[model samples]
Target: TQVTCRNSLKNPLWSLIEIPIISSVTCQTVTGLIFFQNDFCARILLLELKWCVLCLLLNEAELQQRSPPSMISLAGGSPNPNTFPFLSASIQVKNGRTVTFDEATMKRALQYSASNGIPELVTWMKNLQKNLHNPPTASYSPEKGQMDMCVTTGSQEGLCKVFEMLVNPGDNVLLDAPTYSGTLTALRPLGCNLINVPSDQHGMIPAALKKVLSRWDPSEVHKPDSTAPKILYTIPNGGNPTGASMTAERKKEVYELARLYDMLIIEDDPYYFLQFEKVQRWLTSSVSVPFPWAPTFLSMDVDGRIIRTDSFSKILSSGLRIGFVTGPKPLVDRVVLHIQASTMHTSSFTQLMVSQLLHSWGQEGFLQHIDRVIEFYRKQRDAMLSSADKWLKDVAEWHSPSAGMFLWMKLRGVADTQQLIVEKALEKEVLLVPGGVFMINSSDPCPYVRAAFSLSTPEQIDEAFKRLSLLIKDAL
Candidate 1:
């Protein structure tokens, strides 16, 4: 067995220490130490203090090589920035030699960043949050104990740090079944038994969650006690694969459940700004999402159980790898400690570029851009849905997504969708997510597939689904 924890000095007498625990077991190190319950596999001694810095700069080729083949070929949940001409204009770099290269925003980006994020970027995000929700004052700080924000490599890293801070080995975590797979991928290594909850067409069912929590028995071996869930992970806005957006009423109901149960709600809203046109129309008009925009759970939070993670990848560029988290200062402070120990900080260059772009755009410009992007996806979603209605209604069924890119199809009488895709669909050059991949347990049959129209063009979408329908027929 292996034991790991944050670094500390066990004894002051020695500059370095190596303590033999039992027969061959040992605890050793100067800067940090590892305790082993079994015989040492290997041992090394260093006399001089040496330091080295390593940086991994990944370009498109490196990213493609490192990322899973399935992920690279899919019309994923992120925007294709190459399709957006305006974003390219913002990314232009004539030179890093002088501050006056582009003469306007380029000069501002060369400067170092503020501790939390660029001050102006924080202000822009604050104001955008305010407009999204009609909240009081809309001022939240990265200091004090109430509210704060920390920039991260991406929401993946944010979730990793959050898990590091909150989850102890053997703890029980409540996650939405068919949830974001990345969250499962990151947390599984930490040794928590993820309890998957059932969701319907409306996203996470609060009633189902209540039942699960109520049924949890702490006294059972390998079970967590009744203290409360370590965290309640949710992606209320355009949930992954399913594309379900919680209604405002639903948000309130879930919020009440979270408060009553005393569980921290992690509102992962990477696709918050990417709602479908119909959903956008509803929100901008009379209908609103169950969760409030901007301050979100933090706004409704009375006891500080809401922590929201926002990502720039969906609407902006994923290569930038920028995201932020807002929540109670205590939790965020702990996260910052992890950040300090690991990343030191998110990419300063990327942060500066984002800060400069947002500052130039201002809140109103930013809102307009979000609206435009929403409109673009809205058209794509409608086209895909129309195609599915014509080609899939007799064989497969799907609810029209309220927001986000994917149109999740529950295939009738189809099992082993993953195998079907590998054997048949790829041969036809059409790629889609096999629903089982999204589950916490990938062993069982999920009879569902997620088709994204986000990255694909309107012209290609119909052909894609038509080919997919043929594959489904062949599989049957």
Candidate 2:
């Protein structure tokens, strides 16, 4: 039996050709027969046949090389196996269960590994993401060419890599007004023009975003050479400095706007699990209500344009330096290639430890841990809110944050918080980040200031607010 192989050639010299597969003969025999039958066109087809055969052979070799280690790899520059010192390692978890990494696991952890990340840890993270975000599609295999995940040193690292991947030096990038200061720092050195989209208590206002994009005139604006923004970076839940989260409806609106404008949405959500709206019921009762994490921008992504970056830093340990990026495969592949050349991989030791911890916790245990964390932060938030009401109510105004670790206050009569930070607040021994730091144009006058209640006790929060209130009063 013969199978038909069709080759579509669009070159001006040739057209499509259909050839029957000769199962009885080699590719070389087929090529010779084609060349004998037709002149130039047959030669082109024969060359294509040879090229296809070569590709098949190369692919087979790669598959064999990547398969289980049956033969020693003398071709590559892998580190010597015997030189590694660690034999085994162990750690104790919260529930008094101890997890140990044996010799085999230790070897994988210590040595150089895949650029994307360790398979086991990536799989666990992918599963966790599926359970939490419930994305449009779930993809575990990069070979499938669908949405995939890659681990980074932290979400910060992921953000930097993504900016490098997407933004040219003179390109314009959109950000929420009063964005994360860290993001400003990251993008400043790249020479990309930063365009601030107006935001409200519900995060980036969809209407404002649409207006900015619709009215964008490159020639009339300051940066004439810069192109229109191709990306919008946002922290959907409890934005840093702003402490505002977009509602589900708002996220859908923004997602639709992104589609309309033809742009990518970078959702940097480290505080997704820390939302405090339902914490009271979860804290007061024994039975856990399903974790009420806000719907992420990724959940609304129908075109796979949302790149969601998450971290274990806030929920687990900041020192862990582990985060994952979930997005379309092409973007993730570029990030992986960058990682391969740059950091090589996030700390294998940290990846191993995090993987073990997640494995031990399971889904239920993980939810329980987040609940405990939220309860703790909820108390601090209450303390801050109460203190603000008591001491700063007349002088400053702020919206109560529903998630993450900040209170963004707008003082009534202040022109800029930077002057207060430098001259008044510091003198009064109240350390808070000035709002200008979070602005796209840092030199602009800003009355807002970001105060974090994450690390302070109730008494301490009260004291800090009292001091801050006094400073604001004196400034007024």
Candidate 3:
């Protein structure tokens, strides 16, 4: 074995590596040492999934660590975890089952973890990606069109960082209209120019998207055209505010358009697991994932151009603040660098807790849990629908949500919902978000209102819309 330097001189882009037995893979960098376990399993001799980050162009320094029997590891700046006062820990699940964290686990959780994440959790999520969305571009090579993922504080952080990494200050990015207010809040402050693409019940319309991008010739897209935006941001499945999922045809067309225009797509799909109630039969006891869940942009991604963020907040505990970013090696590497400099990786304990849950549940158990969640949300959505029909049928028009928690309601005979929702609805002891906040120009008058069905009871929902109908009448 050549010990280290396993093609370091020639393949400078491969900036990261993993253990011989350990199967976790993440893009560490192009400048740092390329460590390996022995000669490294060529199968697992992973590549640097390229990061589209602010280049940390280090001088070509040849660095690699390889195991030589029992070699003393003196590298890395992590503090000794043995010094921490906390020892064992445990938390009981909903069924009164305890998931204990022993000394070995506590040491890792209480102490500092790698910027990418704890290795076990990283491996688990990567495998989960394979199960959930067998992305076509799934590869470990440091070559172009490689996919990699990193856990984040929340999907929002991952989303925001990726947004920051791709969007230049003046670059006009294609953004979905009436998007998540949180998205508008996160992106608008960055000062990047946005080109709004209209969306209907089926999410972002391809026709509207094409019309906007038609400003510049499609042939010039693959070129380095400064004026043309190279990014299209969307939440295709169970989208926020709108609560709509893009049709399968639109998803295909959107991916093709992105290919044609050479544009990178950011798929912020937090509500993916919340799709309409449909039982997904598991083919295996452990891991035979044959697309039980709905298809994703990642599933169709052949060019490694999509950077998708999935959240645990909606399905699991929001306080846990755990999520993942999956996309091309280069762009994800930038997110890793940003995470290192920002929150210093998501809370290690939370990551471990999630990992522990997954380990105990296995893939089948985890998906069953998701099925329960989907059914719960479906009930909630139906309740809201029932209430809306009973109370506000004539006053508000809305499409039944395909997934997620929110209902987007357009009031009849109302020019804008701001004054009605803010002043009148509040006076009536009812609260709803005015749709203008989700707009690029939040100051403009908007006729729609967003209502969340996740928390309220059927009776309360009925009463709220009853009051809302009265308010709409008053406004008119």
Candidate 4:
């Protein structure tokens, strides 16, 4: 007897062939007939076969998950939970004010929480972004292209996730020349075609960007078939390495170009609060004044094209690994998805700490804290600039940065600073980051070097510049 089966073959577990039963009387045939006659045995057989097929399918699906035991992984996303040992913490602020987290807050931090972040902390960040950037309009709904925020381990992590969400292999990415080395490190492995837009003292030059975009020739690129650059990655305020902040007018021009080119702008402005002019005035005068902040790309993002990443690393503590991304809800949602699958969320304890600090400070207090920080760094900037003027004025030229940490110097007569740094600067006990490392084409000759004054003492700044001057003169 033949049993008719309507096997669509769409499900791989089941076979399309029919089974025929015969009345022949062999021992094996008799056993088979008995098993076939029992519905339970037949069902068991089908289930076992399905299980075997499922195993095979799963094995085929995840080749990377089945990596050999000998394969060592350097690509880990989650930090070891053991490192965080604080059950509770208290921070003292100005005016004898102390903010402390109790057991309840500690418990919430120790245990798992929402993927987006701690809700209260997220609200604080959203308010901060709103007050700081004053984005032309706002929305929380992704469908409406409303702005939203997501907490990240750091701004660097947000940057990595953004690149992952937006860039495919061989996609074009626009970057300000002398870009952050960290940005290059995050994007290089993705195989992106990087186009460098030249920058001046006021960050990315809008006219240069316009010319590059208008005359963009795909044939000139290594990958002609790649899509046109849809993203511009910039460090708008006190740009890393270059230490050039975009003026409000420059930001407006760049924003217009982004609109004209239909591109998304990634504004990684970690040093926004560190702008110095108003802080200098407040420090010098007897009366305190509000800190003046430059207009951010987000302020001009009428079309929701700017994704701004900010960090506590510069303002607060670097070890906290706390930062936030503010942008259109859809893009932020993607970042949250990536976070959920990877680090899960930024540390709840860290978020709680930051939130408590902000709450105690209120808007005025927060502004005051940043003003003090800016004043501290402004002196350092002054020290570095003074040393440069005294020691190497004839040998090197640089624009005194209005914001951020580094002093970018163009060394006269040197073709590449990398060799000088390796052979001479280190030998002289003075160290600096070669400007070539920050260039889009690392092989290109760069006469520049970046000197950071954020951590060094005034004496160290003067001594380092003196040594660097000697090295430059020797090379010449």
**What lDDT does each candidate get?**
0.64, 0.74, 0.75, 0.74
For model 1, residues 1-476, the per-residue Cα lDDT tens digits are 23232222432211222332231112222232222111110111111011111112122322343468676433223244344333122355332222122433333344323335555566667555545653321343322234556777888788888777666556678888888888888889977789988897788888888798886443332222333464788888788989987776767877887655546688888888886533232234554443323235555765556677888998778998988877655456556656655765676567767776676666555666777778788888999999998788877989998888888898887976888776678889988889988998898988989999888887688888888888788777
- Clashing residue pairs for model 2: none
* Model 1 lDDT, full chain set: 0.64
lDDT by residue (tens digit), candidate 4, 1-476: 33333332332222232333222112122211111111211321232233221111111112223568686645433344456575676778666888787766666566555556677788987887776667864743333346888889989999998887676666678999989999999999988789989999988999889888876553432232425577899998888998998888988998888766567799998988888865322322264556568778897777777888999898888999988888876467667766765787788777878888888887667777887889899999999999999999999999999999999999999999999997778888998999999988899999999999999999999999999999999999
Rank by TM-score, highest first. Answer: 3, 2, 4, 1
Whole-model lDDT, model 2: 0.74
Q: For candidate 3, what is the TM-score?
A: 0.84
The digit string of per-residue lDDT tens for model 2 on 1-476 reads: 12233332322211233344333212332421111111212321233343332111112222333778786444445576568999998888777978789998787678766678777889988777776667764642332224689999999999999876666666678999989999999999978789988888899998888888876653323233325576889998999988999888888888887666557789999888889886222322365466668778776665667788998888899998998899866468667756765787898788988888888887778888988998999898999999999999999899999999999999989999899987777788878898998998889999999999999789988998899888888888
Worst 10 residues of 2 by lDDT: 31-40
**Each prediction's Cα RMSD?**
13.1, 10.3, 7.7, 15.3
TM-score of every candidate relative to the true structure: 0.72, 0.81, 0.84, 0.78
Give candidate 4 misplaced runs (Cα > 4 Å): 1-87, 93-95, 139-141, 216-226, 279-289
Give the least accurate 10-residue stretch of model 1, judged by summed lDDT.
40-49
Clashing pairs in 3: 15-29, 49-329, 50-329, 50-330, 51-329, 51-330, 51-331, 52-330, 52-331
Clashes of each: 3, 0, 9, 1
In model 3, which runs have C-alpha deviations exceeding 4 angstroms? Answer: 1-83, 222-225, 277-292
- The CA root-mean-square deviation of candidate 2, after full C-alpha superposition on the true structure, stands at 10.3
| TM-score-superior candidate, 3 or 4 | 3
